[model samples]
Target: MAFHCYLWHGDTATAQGPKRDTLCGDLSMATPPVLTRDWLRKPQSMLRRKASTPEEAVNWLGEVFDQHAEKMTHSQVTGIRRQDRFGSALTDLQAGNDLSWGFPLVGSKYLALAVIVVR
Candidate 1:
């Protein structure tokens, strides 16, 4: 199976497909012919954290949950479906604020993460 990423708004997924122009809608030559897992890596310093591997992602998610458990009420950590939105989700997850979960799909074929904005 190919990699898929998604952007979720809640129990209902806000976006169910890839966002890159090449992957969806009218294709463009500027879009790279090759996609790499590099999209899965969170920038090392941006959020004061990084996750180079699926394992690290899981650990980071747990840390965020633990640190914020006392303050969070209705919000809960959850899974994300793969589509084409890894970059955005990873950004939120790395920030460790409104983001909660960041991990790869069980089969290793896709990356997934969850975002929970408490507004």
Candidate 2:
């Protein structure tokens, strides 16, 4: 089963509503990367933290990516796929170009997040 994933960016302060900028991953995946699934299986400590600033959010996301990258390095295909979906967004965030917010999927047994970037 394929699942649709997106990385959206926008400004929330406008009356026009959230302005979306697609940084990457406007595609469907048969399943999330193995490292991602494994990380999600761990305790939700990191996910529970609140990011009050864009810098903080970026830092948090960086850690998440770091974890994935460490394991992904063992598998070329998985690393490439994961990087394709999230690398640019992380790069942009690290460069101070945008802010990130992750919305957790409600009523789901597994941890699923929809990440939105605020420009």
Candidate 3:
């Protein structure tokens, strides 16, 4: 079973030494990070995420947002339905597997997101 997720660059040093064709000793596989209880609790700390792939991560988030985008707000009043600076990135779960929240761009204000999770 494949799932989608979002991916962001973690504070990792750039490639200095010869690139290791094998990320985790397996050139054909990528060592995905662990999705533990803490991950569900505090995602910021982990910084790193593990999904089927980078693209998958983005798609999942897009779908998540698309579902409840209408209930968010008509703030812009532009009628295009765009995301605002102040919103939930992944919050509003209330107490179930559902949630709604917002996130702010740190390094770059021109943040970009990917849509993952194949239909």
The model with the greatest lDDT is 2
Winner of 2 and 3 under lDDT: 2
lDDT of 2: 0.35
Give the poorly placed runs of model 1, Cα more than 4 Å off: 1-46, 74-119
For each candidate, what TM-score against the reference? 0.28, 0.29, 0.28
What's the count of clashing pairs in each model shown?
A: 6, 0, 16
List ranges where model 3 is wrong by over 4 Å.
1-37, 40-50, 76-119
Summarize candidate 1's per-residue lDDT along 15-99 as a digit string, tens digits: 1235533332222321211222222232322233444543355455455445544433333322333222345545554454343
Preferred candidate (TM-score higher): 1 or 2: 2
Candidate achieving the largest TM-score: 2
Q: Write model 3 residue lDDT over 1-119, tens digit each, in one string.
A: 22334333222211111332233233223321222112233334323334554334434566644554444445422343335321232222111122223322233221113222232
Candidate 1 Cα deviation (angstroms), residue 103: 18
Tens-place lDDT digits, model 2, residues 11-65 = 2221122321221121122222223323223333423344555445545555654
Ranking by TM-score: 2, 3, 1
